[model samples]
Target: MLQSRLFMNLKGIGISFVPRYFFQINLSKIFNEILKYNTKELEEIQVRVRYYNKINQFFTPTEKEKIGKFPFKKTSYAFDAYEISKYFKDKFLWNKDFNDVKWTFKDPTICKSRPLENNKNNILLKLDKNRHFCFLKDDLIFENKKDIAVFRGAVYQTHRKEFFHSYFNKTFCNIGDTSKEASQYRKNFLSKKEQMGYKFIISLEGNDVASNLKWAMSSNSLVLAPKMTCETWFMEGALKPNYHFALIDNENLAQVIDHFRTYPKEAQEIIHNAHKYIKQFLDKKKEFHIGILVLAKYFYYSKQLDLNELGYEREILELIK
Candidate 1:
């Protein structure tokens, strides 16, 4: 229900972002306009509008990722990556890959040594899209929260996990096991809002820069995280050390905790700074803009697409570059 409503509201925003120079009236526009009117309420919508000689794929996230399709085992990481391919696409093109889509809201595959683009300044940072986007609850009690940290997820594969309660006393942290049943696991899960009941939260690197890092940034808790070898949409050029999340090590976690406990003001300040930065930086509005820009670049640089036809698309790509 929430998604249905947001999809409808977002179309107007999408339309306003498009300039009038892209199309002059024609039979296609007439039909497109009629189709738009007929399907007033829907799970999603797909429409293409042309202005002059230029064309834009409306409802399209990016042309790069949408270009190919392949199958894998049930437990494959591609299973999740495959679902993400639907981020933006015409419902009818569900079978297709997001072609010329050089990037996405979050790529499941990235590491620090190998950056996406050669130019650091020109690299486009995207926000990790929450498939279950919803309004976060606001009833959390910030003042009377737990002093210890909490972690609840798959053991996933990563080293330097001494911070996961192995090195810390259980009184100060709780890194639970992974094999609980769905309902029971959910029962133990610390929700985005409920996590406010903690003074400290450990942000360890999972298969990628842990998604929890972003939530931790928005929360009122101090994030104790090590330098991430795996990068994500928000990590590359966005986060800073000692500002967004504290730099911790596999050893001496007790000392790290003691230091923060001694200087509580500094810990609070770090949390406050990260909260402010992420709140402003990862706004949903900007996420939408970045998604579109990625598509524009894929079209502009892709040899697969006829480059001549995408001449006007270069304007948007230029700004992104």
Candidate 2:
């Protein structure tokens, strides 16, 4: 995560520290006007918009008073939220917390949580995007890489510490902790490129979601992780076990690794499925549209926007059908 922060700060410096969110917020209105979704495109957006914001009740004008906007402290999180909320502009409500927001509001509220199954009010946007949304180019194919599984990250959770102890000394595992307070493992930082040399890359859940999961999937190596507990815009819930990733737990990690090592074809297929899942997120225009539409639904349900003012009436109609 330290690496990601430095990269973004350098990137911000390159662009004179202009908030990219501010530009996107302004351009969103124009794009919303000019962009026309065909039936299929609208349908896709409808599915995602509904998934993000499941508010079914229309708040009365009186009921809308309960809604509240939250001021986020982190600049990156605030900027990301503004990119969508600026459309509604102080109209919609959001969770006040950050880093795996766990609270649920009585009224519909936007949030950036792991999207637990029952947390319907937590309307997810791709917040802390620079840290979570990384994709890489892999020149090494699965067959050419070493047969070992590698993991390199901060040990924030007890499960992470257990994982480090479980396989750190194994011949087939190369794992380390990046946190400063960590003991002997503190010196074992592996670069992203270095981890690519192995056939499997471990992606354990940190504070919420696995930050490395995106780039790990993009690599030639297969992603090795347990079932995802939380998800962001990448929709970890939609991913299939043993298809998009090699699902493993503390008990089955080595067995799963050995199975993949013996059956390289299956590993390649899982990598293929991961790449397919990733392809949808690469379309910048569609992603922007989906973000706007998700917030539009938020405003409508909160009664901040009148029914007639939604602008996506045709799309909404088709969505209901």
Candidate 3:
């Protein structure tokens, strides 16, 4: 859970710094736009418009109305970075509340550091060998329990060769559409998969889509992580609905052996150091304990039982009192 004081402090810092960054970048664009429209004929037109009408009337009706309704609207969209920064100043950043902060996760395998374009075939081969994991391809067969399906980012025909080689399951993750089309696309895909006796899963990329994906999964099939790991700020107060699983790689044979060899010294020390830092900053005694209590209450009230009943609650409460 996030403490109010900590939230306020972080919000203040972000509000102060982020706008400055935005403004510096936007200012250059504004200057470029001004230069592009700096011709004599454009200057004459501007002068005539300014003289014939009030300075505000030079703007389109919609723009004028927006300016009138929200005085900062013009500055908010100002091209220059500095002006843009000024526009955002002191405005409560929209997502200050954790209730408004969305959570999501993404497929780490699909989001590997290597460029997919350069290694698509190799990736496909790897998927074929590791048949338990899902692979994104078109023309996926909806057969066997061991196979999980995924949608290819590009054309179906191009992915057919890989699809032919793999076992098929009904569950899949899609990546092609923007948010506007996502709901519809998901519906259609689920319907098709259902017809073929398969279930579907959705993996998303950002906070914007996380809540929607959660809702979809609660009603339909499973929902995978909607955002990448790096996007999440773990301090946020709210926990996403527990229907979604956090997918992590279970240790392989090599990892198991390495852990045993390293556990007594370096690995254990590193883990201890991480815990100490977390305790110092995030879990400092009673204050942190209170935050957890408050979060438990909120989850109980929200009917989010999974969070309320997660295994740590008892141990956390024991520490709190």
On TM-score, the leading prediction is 2
Write the residue-wise lDDT of candidate 2 on 90-194 in tens digits: 444443345575456555555666446777766778788887788999999999998999988887788887777777778877887788783666646788999
Order of all candidates by lDDT, from best down to worst? 2, 1, 3
Give lDDT per model, in order: 0.45, 0.73, 0.26
Give the poorly placed runs of model 3, Cα more than 4 Å off. 1-198, 206-211, 226-243, 246-321
Cand. 2 TM to true fold: 0.84
- Candidates 1 and 2 compared: the better one by TM-score is 2
lDDT of 3 by residue, 147-225 (tens): 2223322212223223322312322323232223333222223332332222233333332122222222222222233
**Candidate with the larger lDDT of 1 and 3:** 1
Off by over 4 Å in 2: 1-35, 60-72, 91-96, 102-106, 310-321
Task: Write model 1 residue lDDT over 31-124, tens digit each, in one string.
Answer: 2332343343211112111100022222232323332233332212223233222232212122122111222223122111123333221222
- Model 1 residue 184 CA deviation (Å) reads 17
Candidate 2: pairs in clash: none
TM match of model 3 to true structure: 0.21
lDDT at residue 115 of model 2 (Cα atoms): 48
Q: lDDT of candidate 3 vs native?
A: 0.26
lDDT of 1 at 203: 76
